[model samples]
Target: MGLRRKLLVSIGLILAILLVLLYLATSVILMSSFSNLEEQLVLQDVNRALRVLETEVLELNRLLRDWAAWDETYAFIETGHPSYVAQNLDDAVFANLRLNLMIFVRYPDQILYSKAFDPQGNRPAEIPRGLYAYLTPESALFNLPHPDSSVAGILPLPEGPLLVAAQPVLTSRYQGPVHGALIFGRFLSAAELARLSQMIHLNIDVRAYDDPSLPSDFQEVRSSLTREKPLVVQTPGANSVAGYALIADLLGRPALITRVVATRDIYYAGQAAQNYIFLSLLAIGLVFGEATLILMDRLVISRLSNLSTSVTRIRTSGDLTERMAESGKDE
Candidate 1:
C-alpha cells in the first residue's frame, strides 16, 4: 500500500484498539461502581420499609401490654365478663387499632373468648380457623413461663399473614400470678400494606414463600435467598433494579419475600457519561490524526518522493545537473 493510505489505516486501527480497551475498562470499573451504589441505595430503601413493618409489630406489642396488664382485663379473662366485651370490644376500637382478631385463652389450651372484626366493613367477621394452631403449647403465645416475658411475632396462617402478640394478663401495676394469655392479631392485609408503604415512602411488595402461586420475580428472588445471601439484588430491566429479602416467620422458616424496586438513574448516568467521553475522545483523535498525516506528508513524505523522482531521472537520462527539493522545516 502507498504510504499515505498505510499511515491512515495504521492510525485508525490503533485508535480503534485504544477506544475498545478504554470502553471495556470503563464498563468494568465504572459500571461496577454504579451498580454497587444502586444496590446499596435500593437495599436501604427496602430495609427502611422492612424496619417500618417491624416497628409496627413492636408498637402493636406495646399496645397489647397496655390492655393485658389492665385491672379490667385481669378480671374479664377469669369472669368471662359480658360487660367487658360490651364496654371494650367496640367495632371502632377494632377499626382504629386495625385489629382482626383477639382471643383470651389459658395456658396449654382453654379458649375463653375470641372476636374477629372486619375493619373495612365495620362488622363482626369469622375468626381464622387456623388461629388455634398457633396458640397451642408448642407455640410461643401460650407457653409463657414469666409475666415479664411476652410474645410478639409473625404468624403465616392459611387465611393470611398475621402480626400477633400474646401477653400474660396481669394487674395494672405489673403484678401477676399469671392467669391466661391475651392474644391479639392483625392481618397484614392489602390495606395495611398500603398504609405501611405510604408511611415508609418506598414501594414494597411482600409474597408468601410457600403459597401455591407467586409472581415470577418473587420466585426468581426466592431462589437467590440462600443462607449466605438473605438479601439479593437484581436488574430486571435496562431502566430498573431491585432488592429482595426473605421474611422469616417465628419458627425461622421462610414465610414471606419482600422486594423493593428502583429506577436505574445512576447506572444510566454512568453509561451516558462513558459514551459522551468516548465520543469526545473519538472526535479529538480523528482531528489529531488528520493533522498528523498532513504534517508528515508536507514535511517528509512529499519531499522524499520528489528526491527519488529527481534521482531516477538523473540515472536514466545521464543528466547529473538535476537537484532534489529540500525544505527548511524539520521533518
Candidate 2:
C-alpha cells in the first residue's frame, strides 16, 4: 500500500481499539452512577415510609393515652356497672375517642368487657372469645406489665396470631393505686397495612405471631426479627440492578414489608447513558482519524509521492535537478 494508505490504516485500527476501550470505560462509569442514583432513590423512599410510620404511631399513641385517662372509663370500670359501660360504649364516644374498639380488661379478675364500633358510631357485639381473649384481660393483657418487670413485652396468642398489649388500670380511690389492668387494642387489618404500603409504594405482607407453632404471615421466611437492616434480593446480570427491599414493622405486629424493582429497567437506563457516551466518543474518534489521514496525506504521502516522481524523472533524463509539481490541497 502507499504511505498515506498505510498510515491511515494504522491510525484507524489504533483509534478503533481506543474507542472500544473508551466505550467500555464509559459504560462502567455510567453503570456505577446509575446504580448509586437508584440506591439513593430507594433509600429515600424507605425513609419516607419510616417517617409516615412514626407519625402514625405517635398519633395512635396520643389517642390511646387520652382514652386511658378518661374519667368515664374509670367510673364505669370502678363501679362494675355493665349496663352503664354498655351505655357509655356509644358511637358518639367511639367517634370522639377515635378508636375502633373499647376494651376494659379487669385485671386480677381476668374478665374482659369489650365493645366494638364502626367509624360511624354504631356499637356492635363484642368480638368472639377466640379473637378477643388475647387482646383483653383474659389473656393477661401481656404488653402492659410494670416497666421494671420482665413481662413488659407484648405476647402473642397460640391459635391465632395476635400480640396483646396490657395497660394497668389504676384506681383513684387510693390515689392512683394499681387496682387491675385494662386491655385496649385494634387488630392490624390487612387493609390498613395495605394503605401503609401504598403510601410508600411497597408491596408489604405483615404477620403477627405469639405462638411458634402457628403459621406466620411472612410466608415462613426464616429471618431474624431483630435485624435493623433491610434484607436485599438481588437481580441477575452484570448490567442489571433489580432488587427487593425487606423492611420490618414492630409496632402492632412483627411484619415484613417488601419492595421490588426490575433489573430490565435499570439496565435500560444505564445502557441509554452508556450509548450516548459511546456515540460521542465515536464521533471524536472519527474526527481524529480523519484529521490524521489528512495530515499524513499532505505532509508525508505527498512528499513521498513527489520524491518518487522526481527520482523517476532524474533517472529517465539523466539530470541532477528535476522537480515534480505538488497537486492537492486538503480543505
Per-model TM-score, in order, reads 0.92, 0.71
lDDT of 2 by residue, 230-288 (tens): 54434434544333334333344444343333344655677787888888899999998
Which candidate has the highest TM-score of all? 1
Q: Model 1, 260: alpha-carbon shift in Å? A: 1.4
Residue 162 in model 1: shift from native, Å? 0.8
- Once model 1 is optimally superposed onto the true structure by TM-score, how far is the C-alpha of residue 274 displaced, in angstroms? 2.5
What's the residue-level lDDT of 43 in candidate 2? 54
User: How much lDDT does each candidate structure score?
Assistant: 0.84, 0.54
lDDT of 1 by residue, 118-167 (tens): 99778999989877777787678887757897878787888888899988
lDDT of 2: 0.54
Worst 10 residues of 1 by lDDT: 322-331
- State the lDDT at 17 in candidate 1: 88
Which regions of candidate 1 fall more than 4 Å away from where they truly are? 321-325, 329-331
